[model samples]
Target: MSTLEIRDLHVSVDTETGPKEILRGVDLTVSSGQTHAIMGPNGSGKSTLAYSLAGHPKYTVTSGTVTLDGEDVLAMSVDERARAGLFLAMQYPVEVPGVSVSNFLRTAKTAVDGESPKLRTWVKDVKNSMQSLAIDDAFAERDLNTGFSGGEKKRHEILQLELLKPKFAVLDETDSGLDIDALRVVSDGVNRFTADGDKGVMLITHYTRILRYIKPDHVHVFIAGRVAEEGGPELADKLEEHGYVDYAGASA
Candidate 1:
């Protein structure tokens, strides 16, 4: 089984004044067949940790080590990270004006696998995935995320997750804007991806709503860029009842 390890990770971002530190010494490990839920208040470095792992240029790793199966993840470029089996589903997916969803998915799959998928099987797979996600057939012909609703964008992200089948996925606030119905659809998609017990997930969210649909093996409470508590699914139930107030004050 593959493992993704983050050790004493410290990241920062440049601002108007200067470099502002975000993640201050955080550590976590996710192995295959495990799902870890990261819960925290706003500005607690949840997204920073996600982006840092995906090798976003905006966030700089000042000090830390991120390894995938013992290979240095921090050393690889963004695309190289994808090829290494890491995927990130952004909270707010950006629009790609000129790229059609069909073309985009095919291109990404080719890049990740180092070879193009056969036309016949690729077409059938894309069609089946889209139908399962309740996505319209015409969506494949539409430009990626252009004029798409929040739910549409999020669904498309999961579509990629389904097709590419990454070793680990960092889902950053994927449930933020989805309604109850859309939420169920999206959550089901994630469940299908992990049902095989071979994929790992780092689900970042502010609420326990999604956790109801996607059960995590471990729950971590992030306070001030550090994990304040770790437990089983019971921890999520506590968060729902007590919220992060107690943890916030302690971290202060």
Candidate 2:
């Protein structure tokens, strides 16, 4: 089984004011077939953690290490990290006006897997993934994320997740701005990806509604850029009931 491990990870982003620290000694581990949820208030560095793990250049690793399936992820380039089985679904997927969804997906798959899939087979796979995600086949011919709704963008992310089939996935705020129907569709795609025995997931979300669909195996509460609480499925329930007030105050 694959695993992603983070040990005392500190991240900084360069700003005009100088280097600004975002993630403060964050540690997390996710193993194959399991789902972990990270819950935090705004500005707690949740997105920073996701971007750093994905080897984004803007987020520098000031200290600590990230490993995927026992390989050093921090040392790998962003493309190499992706080839090594690391995937990050961003909160805001950038729009590429001239890039059609089908073409973008093909290029991404070729880049990550180091070879192009046969055209006929690849089209079939894309069709199946879109159908599974409840997305219309016509959407594949449209430009990537151009004028798409937030829910549609998030589902498109999951579409990549299914098609790419990475060993470890970090989903950052994927549930944001999704209505109940869209949430179910996105969650179904995630569930399909991890339902097997060799993929792991780290879902970063602010709301518990998505958890109802994915059913995380563990939950961690991020307070002031640190994990202040961790537990089983019940933790998500508690957060839904009382919100992050108590945990947010604990790390103050």
Candidate 3:
């Protein structure tokens, strides 16, 4: 099984004042076949951790080591990381005005797999995945995420997950803005991806609702950019009842 390890990760971002630290010496590990839930309140550096793992230029890794199966992830370029089996489904998926969803998915799949898929098989696979996600056939011809509803955008993100089949997926608040039906559809798609027990998932969110659908093997409570407490599914229940108020002092 593959492993993604994070050790003493400290990240900072440039503000109008200066570079401000967000993640403060955080550490975690996610192995294939496990789903890790990172829960926290707003401004608690949860998204920072997600973007950092994806090597977003806005967040600089001042000191840390992120590795995927003993390979240096911090050193790899953004696309290189994806090719190495790292995928990030952004909370706010960006709009690619001119790129058709069909073309974008094909391009991304080719880039990750190092070869283009056979046209016939690729078409069939895309059609099936889209159908499973309840996406309309016309969506494949539309511009990627352009003018789509929040639920539509999120569903499209899962579409990419199904097609790309990355070793690890970091989903940043995927449950946000999703209605009950859409949530179930998206959660089911994630379940399908991890059903083989060979994929790792880092699900970052503020609520425990998604946990009901996609159970996590470990639940990490993030406070002030660090892990304040961690437990099994039980911890998510606690957060749902108590919220992050108990961990408020960590930031001070």
TM-score against native, each model: 0.99, 0.97, 0.99
Q: How does residue 104 of candidate 3 score in lDDT?
A: 96
Clashing pairs in 2: none
Which regions of candidate 1 deviate over 4 angstroms?
Answer: none
TM-score: model 2 vs. ground truth? 0.97
Q: Which sections of candidate 2 miss by over 4 Å?
A: none
What tens digits encode model 1's per-residue C-alpha lDDT throughout 78-117?
9999999999999989899999999999999999999999
lDDT-wise, the better of 1 and 2 is 1
Question: Least accurate stretch of 10 residues (summed lDDT) in model 1?
Answer: 243-252
Candidate 2 has its poorest 10 consecutive residues by lDDT at 243-252
Q: Compared to the true structure, candidate 3 yields what TM-score?
A: 0.99
Per-model lDDT: 0.95, 0.91, 0.95
lDDT of 1 at 17: 98
Candidate structures ordered by TM-score, highest first? 3, 1, 2
